[model samples]
Target chain A: MAPVVERAREVRYATAAELPEAIVGADVLFAYDFFSSAIPDAWPAADALEWIHVASTGVDAILSPELRASDVVLTNSRGVFDEAIAEYVLGQVLSFAKDLPRSWELQQARRWVHRESERVAGTSALVIGTGQIGRAIARLLRAAGIRVSGSGRRARTDDPDFGTVTAQEDLHEALAGADWVVCIAPLTEATRGMLDGAAFRAMADHARLINVGRGESVVTDDLVTALREGAIAGAALDVLDTEPLPDDHPLWDLPDVRITPHNSGDFVGWRDALVRVFTDNFARWVDEEPLRDVVDTSLGYVPTDGSAR
Target chain B: MAPVVERAREVRYATAAELPEAIVGADVLFAYDFFSSAIPDAWPAADALEWIHVASTGVDAILSPELRASDVVLTNSRGVFDEAIAEYVLGQVLSFAKDLPRSWELQQARRWVHRESERVAGTSALVIGTGQIGRAIARLLRAAGIRVSGSGRRARTDDPDFGTVTAQEDLHEALAGADWVVCIAPLTEATRGMLDGAAFRAMADHARLINVGRGESVVTDDLVTALREGAIAGAALDVLDTEPLPDDHPLWDLPDVRITPHNSGDFVGWRDALVRVFTDNFARWVDEEPLRDVVDTSLGYVPTDGSAR
Candidate 1:
């Protein structure tokens, strides 16, 4: 940001509350606190704003109807979180399959009980998102020998990463055959509350859910019921509807549930990486060249047809 | 074993104490608690023994001077545990990279502290063995986007799975470059106590050691010293110098040590898979065809040239 600071006529850094005034005459805005919901309120003040670049892969947080209807172009840090989140998701899957949490507890007690672990090779995984992060996870999991399928907004027969793309509409039918269902969809009307009790009920008794997507995508209470009733085996949630997930939340102590702080994609040096993405895009903006990761705000995501990679 | 019962004149199961008498008239033996040391004691009674099949990858427990000198053929369940151990190793690597154990502790206390994690992709791994299981691990890690190299009995500039395999004697030099050191080598005179004090000292302070191979390959005291002095980052040991490690062993309370009872290769249905290998070999033996995974007695492993998959 320092290198590009001199290029702007005036540069302003502001908190969510100060965004309205800060965005008044700004031609470009960098949403550093990407999850901040002040964008809608500040939208009326973005008088000369032509572009808004976010330091996150998901644009749902700032994608308001007014901005989508306007001429302001939106871009995101799309490719940045792909590998990091993919690695995180794979770690969770392996942790569950290998019974690592139990081993940690047993190690604490100095217990040497040898348990038989499941092999990841032949097991199947159903990735709910077909976006870059989801594709990265599918590739990584496939490399680990897990058969990977996908459930996206639309069904496709020939996806390079996910061999069979099941339509999100038929998610329950797809869940029945999967050993693990990974939800990595963005937050949208259709995606929110997608993994409700009924979806969990459709999963196999041994299937586990791994959610690294938006917290709002899953119905928290319904998920709690699913885990309690044994409708599904367990879950590894990196995001929650309410976070730092209320210290006294039921999910905190669920038997087999794994709760990781929403830092899956925040790998070491990620801040620098995010800045690099913004600066690179800023350089393109100054040069009047094509920008990268432009979001299709109407869809509340960077559509696959766009230059997503 | 029951299916192959009719083909043999007699099928006998023997404990270490009763093995001497049990081997009196046996033509073939299936060494089932593969780590059993009773074979040498029962050797003299195995007058008619033509072959010995082990239910394990490592034949160290059954390999004896007499058995090597004798005409008896030695075969093992080699391919059975390759994928299983590879997945376990991958899991351990991910577990370490993602700081999952700490997350488990925090989750226990309902604490949400977001920490940056390392990326597994693009990081390098030094796989210390070019055998079947080691090869499997190399392939899986490579699939996860990790750069893989190997250390074997001999060095090679160009190899299939491991591009540049360092000689076992130059292991210290190789230790400096890898983010992860995966030990999956078979135990032999050269391998025993291989990872000693000097070797640990040569490794980068940030490097981690994962041992799925024989425990004797690593000197316990030296590894303890290495961890204590920060000679190396940490270790995840699936095998230990002592089985059912003493309740008060130093490793139990070591900050970064992960101790799992030697079950890295034992996945669900693994016992059945090992049996299938033996039964298939038995059927071949009855038909007078070449057996699979025949251990090269002089080399103490199924030589790479000996039809090893």
Candidate 2:
């Protein structure tokens, strides 16, 4: 925000209610966190709004019907979270493979338990998305010697990162052999509640699921049931259907579930990075040149051209 | 053992006390665990012993005075543990970098705490050994985007893994900027008790120490004091001064210290791999071919020619 205040031609700071008045003449809208029900009510006032930029990769929260129907350009901070989210996924994978939680449990009890651990080198992972974040996760996992396959909306036979990118329709087949299933796909009408009870049942009994995507991508109740019934070994979810999960949420107390507030891709100075991404895009917006990370508002994400598959 | 029993001209099985009688007519000795206090007493009876092989990497446990002075060849299972130990070290480093323990604590209390995590890339590590295990650790860490400097018995300027390997004498200088200090050097008179109070003091307050080398390489009491006083952030010790880590040891209860019972390198099927390493050498021995992983007994381990540096 400081960077933008100093660099932008004009910066107007206003609350949700004040946004309707403020949007009357603004050309660019930088929706930081975009958490306002007032956004739609204020949408009629954005008469001169030429572009809308979100500080987050997920634009669903800010994608009002009016805005979606408008000719205004939509862009997001896509590449910014790539490496951080990749590292988080890798960290969780290694934690599960090395059994770090068990080690801690033994440490607390003053026990010296020596158990043979699984090797990550020859293990396999089925990454559920072929976006930048998922690609980054695949790259890092491969770098550590894991066998990685990716799944996208469509099947790809020529992917260099993942030799054959599995189609979303064939995800269950991939899940059966995967030691890890990482979800980093974007949230959209098509993807919401995609990982349901059937998906969980398809996964190997020893396989672990990691959700760093959106909470709605998984059916929370089904996940709880899967973990309780041991249909899958465990899960590490950074995102949940509800933010600040309710005190009585069964997922919170499950021994096999590791819950982290949706901060997987966040590192120190992330806000600064987010601002930098927008500022760079803003410079392009001012120049009327093509912007980076422009999203297809209808798809609710920056559609991959199957290049990174 | 199954492979050896099938291939050997004669396979003799005996307890430590019975070893003296069994070893009299044996040409090769496969010391499985080699736990006998009677090995030195039985040395005189091994008139026909031409070679000795141990199932474990560290030969210090089986390197008896009489055996070292004898003409018998000695070898160890070196390459077997390289990848496993490297993965263990990387897992621990990621655990610390991601603050997984804090996340777990927050989860246990059903708190959705969001905290910024540190990035592993662009961080520095000072690996305190240049041997196979140390090099493996450095390689894995570097793969994960860390700037790694290695330390060995002597300074190496031509090492490819590390630009300029620091000598053991200058470890303190390396420790100053390191986020991770991994000790995987062999247990030798010079390396024993190398990481003392002064060494801990030289590290950054947030840096962690990972010891997968040998327990005696660190002064247990100094490590306890350092961890207790927060001189160092934490430690993941696979090796401690005591095996099975006496239930009453303070290290067991230290919040920051993660203790694994010296099994960091013990992966499933490790025994089979160890035997394969020995059996491959045995085949070479039977054919009058030179053996692999031959140890220079006078130096107490495989003498590196600075080739791996």
Candidate 3:
């Protein structure tokens, strides 16, 4: 569908400091940092607010309850971060299989230690949330000869690359055979504690976990307990419920855990990607085409929204 | 032509030390540790010595000059180590791109850091040799969306997966566009010191080098100079001119360089892989089919001997 074209007036900028005049009369709302205390709680229902675009994939913070409840079309920068985070996941999987960290320590000691490594081929991977990021990972892993299974809130029989896909209720069955379990689900109320002790126990003994999604989805205490007891192989985490993880957190000392400070999808060109995503969304909204990455306020997810189809 | 096989009426054990008289007349030979004193300098010219196979890919030390010049056909275990070493290369590539070593150090200090990382997609890789291991690396890199090129003694046009394959003479040209330069070529008289300052200078500034083939193939001093000057982004080395890279070596202090003690392919199942290859070759010999991986006595590389084909 061709987008509805709204006439352009002067481009209004919300500089995050001084509010650029009331955008009620403007045709577009470029909300970069409005969620961070810069935006007024309420505004007049104006022409400027016809299309609201967020810089982040998750619109929970940016969308005031009323904004989401309103008719203003909302879109997000969702696809921008997939390649970066998927690459991060692949890197973590390789590091774990090849024992690169241990090799580095041995190198430091000038020792010729030989360690056996597992091949990714013939291994099974369980990907939670068959979103853009998860789909991209499935394609890449499938190319490498891995068997990938995807899990989301509902079964997706259309995604053929993932051999066995199921809804949230079947997560346990999915994890039973996976050698690598990737968590990329957003933090919805239902998913907040989805990966708790029970989930951990379902994973294979040699399974490795990677979280580039919402940290709250995984119960940190359960993860630590699993790692300490050797219930699972290891983990590589780029997200946490708390930013700047506390220095005294026991997770820091977990023997097989790898931690990154919430930077999985951030890269050199990420800002440019973010800008591109927003610019395209703006164009789509201006032309009145169904907006891409439209969030389902009720479900709290950027819906499939027919964009993928 | 099938491999020549003979029956053993009597067998002798050199490493086992207890030679049985019942095996003295054995026509077939299985010499393990037979060279504890000295490798037999003279070819025995035993009528039963129709086939000789070495467990190692490199038979330089195993084959005495006489054995190499002998009339008996011989083969070496060439395919055994390829997969294991290719797995190692994948590890190094992932580690470098993910900033894994730095992350590990930070984790140890309980410091949370978020660093920019690289994606493997759309990058160019240069494999210096187009042998079993190099081909394996190419397959993995291709699966990861990297443009792969290779250099071999002879360039064949049929291998279209290689973006820009070339003959050995064009290696410098191949290195120019490479984001990753992997060396897995055999160590031959002509290949020794092949990777020097001049070669490193030709590589892109952000490119990484991984040497898993042979230590003698790289000039350590030149490599160190190139790395120190930032001629290339970094290096992940599994082999060095000297094994167990001396404690005081300057390369150890370079933060950008990752060192391993020549242990790229020594995995748990390596011995079994060698035995399997050997057994297959023996079976082939018994069938009077052409032997595989026969070395050219004159060139020290398999297949340089035109008679093998």
* Alpha carbon deviation, residue B1, candidate 3 (Å): 27
Residue-level lDDT of model 3, residues A102-150, one tens digit each, is 8777766766775676666688899998877787778877876778889
- Chain A TM-scores, candidates in order: 0.96, 0.94, 0.86
Please report the TM-score between candidate 1 and the true structure. Answer: 0.97
lDDT-wise, the better of 1 and 3 is 1
Candidate 1 lDDT score at position A300? 84
lDDT of 1 at A84: 87
Which pairs of residues clash in candidate 2, taking residues 3 or more apart in a chain or in different chains?
none
Better of 1 and 3 by DockQ: 1
Best by TM-score: 1
**Candidate 1 residues B1-309, lDDT tens each?**
656755565788778899999899789888875445789988888999999999898888888899999999999888988988898898989888889898989999989999999999999999998998998999999999899999998889788888999998789999989999999989999899999999998899999999999999999999999999999999999998789889989999898899988988889998899888988898899889999888998888998831346
TM-score per prediction, in order, is: 0.97, 0.94, 0.87
Candidate 1: docking tier: high
The model with the greater TM-score, 1 or 2, is 1
The TM-score obtained for chain B by all candidates, in the order given, is 0.97, 0.94, 0.81
Stretches off by above 4 angstroms in model 1 are: A306-308, B306-308
Query: lDDT by residue for model 3 over B74-189, one digit each (tens)?
Result: 56677667666776787788778878888888988999977887777888889987766777788888888888988878766666445556887777888898999999887777
Candidate 1, number of clashes: 0
